[model samples]
Target: MKLFFQNKLYILAGILGLATSCEKEFFPQPPSAKVAKETTKLEASFTATPPLSLSDAYWKTADYLNIPLTDLSKNELYSDGFLNMTGTFKGLSSFNKGEDPKVMMKAAYDKTRVYIYIEWTDSDFSPEFAASIFNGPNDPLKPDTFRRWTSQGNSDKVALAFDIANASSATGTFDVVGCAASCHQNKMQTATGSVDIWNWDLALSDPLGFARDMMTDGTKGLHDDEGDNLASQNKIIQGNSRSAPIFEWDGTQQSYKRPDGKITLLDPGFYLLNKTPYIGDLDKGDKIYHDADYGCNHCHGEFGGGVGTIGEATAFASTGFAGKYSRASIKSYSASELHPGLSYWQKVPAANQDDLIAYIKGLGSIPGYYLKDPTGSSANIWSVSNVVRGRINTGSVHTNYKVILVRDLTTGNADDVQFLSPKGKSFPFGVALMDHDGKNHIGSLKHLLTFKL
Candidate 1:
């Protein structure tokens, strides 16, 4: 009887163990993702010859370190920009986990430059900047009702932070923090430390082929690196305490054919770049849009473009994807831009053309910024992404981002960090990922980088 009872007990214990293992494998916990094996130190080995191209076959041989990114939307300064979709957007803490919250980083250095490569997944392709579609005419009593931005805002971004002085750790005292040290309350501003920031903005800087080089010092927010700039805000404040984009494509569509035969657009990028300054009267556009006799109200309904589906139609009542019909279905065009494959422009009467365009410009998806190539210290870090160069998978629901950032091994900029000689034997840094957000991000701290000699 004793032997039989002992065997019975063992059987029960085995069943319980199997259940626990199954639960552990299936029902995983949050704040951590199942990713590739992580390496301790990120090593940058010296290479005598290296191709600097983003899609080079030579990069396949480099060793990489995988880093996990966790939820960072709980900071005091973490904001969801004009659209507050925290815990709902596609990332770490979001209910709908879209992207795998992991980054694979690789490093290599030549005689003159250091190259850093990173790859991560993002579900959405948010290339458009801020547009101004749903704004109403200057209303004195309700100025806030018709603000500039809407849900169709936010851009994708990634940033790296390094110690400027002996400030490798976040606080310059304790080595626990990484880039989080720079972020004091809102943006990164330490009480006694400074950091050199390399921000790669998909919308603002990528189109111009550079990461924005910036610096932060004791309690001071982010500022530009001396010499050149990557971009500037193309905003203009109007009478009702609201702002609008100061520029637009002068009804012209310009494009650039890449070496890969990808035709990248250079005009009306949703943001202005080499486009004409905006010259429109919102009141005039609004009047022509609602004119019963000659208005598009017959087909597009009361407000925007589609029949009550678009934002500008109901003054932005309808939501995302530009109200079913989409801008692609009905977009402005020029004879010069017309190709054998398509046509989205209609020849409207010259009298109504300007007014209709003015109203269209008032809608939200307009660009609140503009771009220019960088120079000086700011241009030190040459950057590229798969999205900008038309190197990404066009058919995927959400594509991955493979970015390459290369900079001089020793740029003698007063505001920049130097990685000279044995001093760079070991370096600590931080990285942040922003998914359609300006402030809130998911990142890790205190990642050590070592030189492989």
Candidate 2:
């Protein structure tokens, strides 16, 4: 009887162990599985409605269609239906590692227009003001008097990128990673594909014009040359050279002078020659022209005489008069009101006199043109029509921006991506914001956008 009782105890222990093993094998769970489930649960859809108008009244209605955009950092969703997205930017080229402030976004659309409203906190507002042309003797070392280039000293801006072609069908990558898939270095070249970019530069196209419509494809190709290199190649294209000096009227001298207090001269370039002429007080006395404070001769003159090649002469004429005796003639003519028998000014044909006058007249009146072509080109694979407005609350350190962008469902351009499809179709997009100082901006991350009528 003792042996039989021991056998029964052993059998019961074996049975218990087997049951525990089965439970462990069948009910295995991993942390990654839990995360996947949470992500799937939050992959929600958004709907867009037509607004009565594309004004402030229409944006007010967005309060009703609020959808929560989860803040990936905190793993929390804002209670209100605002997509509160955050990121940090780091790249040796543009920025250092810095936290991007929270950005809230809401969007609405009409039959002809799409309106997106964004609000964020900013402490300063930097507009594209005129650069200080007055470079005195102490200008180079004086930090206060130094001026940054427009490209370097610009206003805040925002950009929106859209994957309209759904080109990720093959890789199934953009569907998952969105804009990041296309943003890699050397990955966005024309050979790869193109993405639509709607860039809103505050100083360039704030109240009157539309966003700069741009497209990113491969880095190699003719478009890149036209967009990047051709501007400085001394190529005499229609829009190749577009800078003119800023001049002010000198009431005492009864003439127009540059901000640096020198007589302004005509720019013989294409754009300036066609424009109107400066019509300030005519100098009955003498016209004193000063060499450009910053010019090619200032740097290159050490090797050769102060003279530059004809191309350089054309390019840097605004820096100073260009010719063998151009500098001396400019000064002597200003004092005597007579040409100094110089080959450069004497070569001006009678037929071109009106153009010279027109060029001079437009001086100080025409504003600087920084954008190559604000209207965009079909070759660039992008186009946009937009209206934007903004209000800044200094005390709150926040600025609200409203943008209305209009485009066709299908632009019918080969470079452009077609968005005319079923209502449930989805696309990937991203937004970047620059603060008032224009120093910092959000970088990385793309959001999902679904179409609903």
Candidate 3:
């Protein structure tokens, strides 16, 4: 069955571009926000012959196995290996509801690395705004700003989660239910234990570079457990930092406001924070940081009344002093408040750089820090490329991406799960895709990966 899929991919590679007309209707669409009652399982066996290169030619190799991801809820699974994984993704927030976008995926791997390919249908190719480009919907001249909680102004993203020890032994619900088990009103906050996350964001982590290495330990707190804090908060600051007064729609005019004179609108869009200065006296108050409610706590979790560390203090202040009503005025501040000297809010502090570098080096002795460029360096173990030809749906403009990640089977890093030996070991994993618009995502299905000679 796997060989059939591999052969089909190669055979269709040539005519795949020409078959777009019929490809749109090739897969069945699942209903919106429909959860699967039964668990979906996918298995991948090891192959001695891996792809010779991480390029189009290598992907055509017969050694690479193929699997079709169809509507799991509808039981549309097939064994022919055709690339037919397509379905709509439901919106996570109430503001954007009933949105169901479709996506497809393929995967392969070698002894030292794993490869994944994903393609989703989207009408727009939204990239994260350049530092100079304004991202706010309200003002064209203003600097770019966007919400931290949502992907409104940012680039598209894809994430994969691995359950290290296996579902039965997992400390959290991730092994049994996948990501949905961790998601809650507080943004995927779980009770205990951690899940390894490989998140690829076009803007935050360039395609060719490393995916944002992150982990979420279903902790109840906001500060420690949240994934991708920098990107999320940057969006929040931009979404709230608007030139004109923010307004909300009352199903009529976009002029609704809270009794305390705060903007009631949920999706304020993106704006550049550094471009917008504090209008009032710094000591007295700033409307953008103080008066507005940017919903930073939705993802940041909670940091009690300014912790001792600079990062903790920033998180505390930016989250309106742990969601207190009195601190609502501080919500308008820019992302700079989170990292004073950094051009980007997410940049790691210079003091912490060495520790981070040492940590990455410890991870399989990879040689360089995860943030460093791999080109012309001994740390060039990962190879990534955007797969453009496999896009099938003409109804929308979309993109496909492939990532080749190499690492030692065993990495001594405490946070990292060591593959050790693959002969009898099985690793459980899941995937999520964020569409081009940055509005919706399809996530939370589990797969078991094994390597065999």
Candidate 1, residue 347: how far the Cα is off, in Å: 12
Model 1 regions more than 4 Å off: 1-38, 75-81, 84-91, 95-99, 136-144, 147-152, 168-176, 238-241, 251-267, 308-352, 388-396, 422-424
Off by over 4 Å in 3: 1-58, 61-104, 129-135, 139-152, 165-172, 184-186, 220-383, 387-399, 403-407, 437-439
Question: What are the per-residue Cα lDDT tens digits for candidate 3 across 1-453?
Answer: 999998788668636744765443444356565222221333233545554235544344323322223221221221111111112232332111223333434445567655554444444443332211111122222232351111123345666676543322232465566654444443544456555666665544432344555555544322211222223222223333222211111112112231122332211111111112112222121111221242222232222223332233333322111111111132223234653423322343434333322221111111000112222212222335352211112235443445444444655544445667666666677676654323245554666555544
For model 1, what is the C-alpha lDDT against the true structure?
A: 0.60
Q: Compose the digit string of candidate 1's lDDT tens values, residues 160-226.
A: 8888864432444314677766766554676566788888877677666678898887755688898
The alpha-carbon deviation from the true structure for residue 345 of candidate 1, after best TM-score superposition, in angstroms, is: 12
Q: How much does each candidate deviate from the true structure in C-alpha RMSD? A: 11.7, 19.4, 21.1
TM-score for each of the candidates: 0.73, 0.45, 0.44
Per-structure clash totals for the candidates: 16, 14, 31
lDDT for 281 (candidate 1)? 62
The candidate that achieves the highest lDDT relative to the unseen native structure: 1
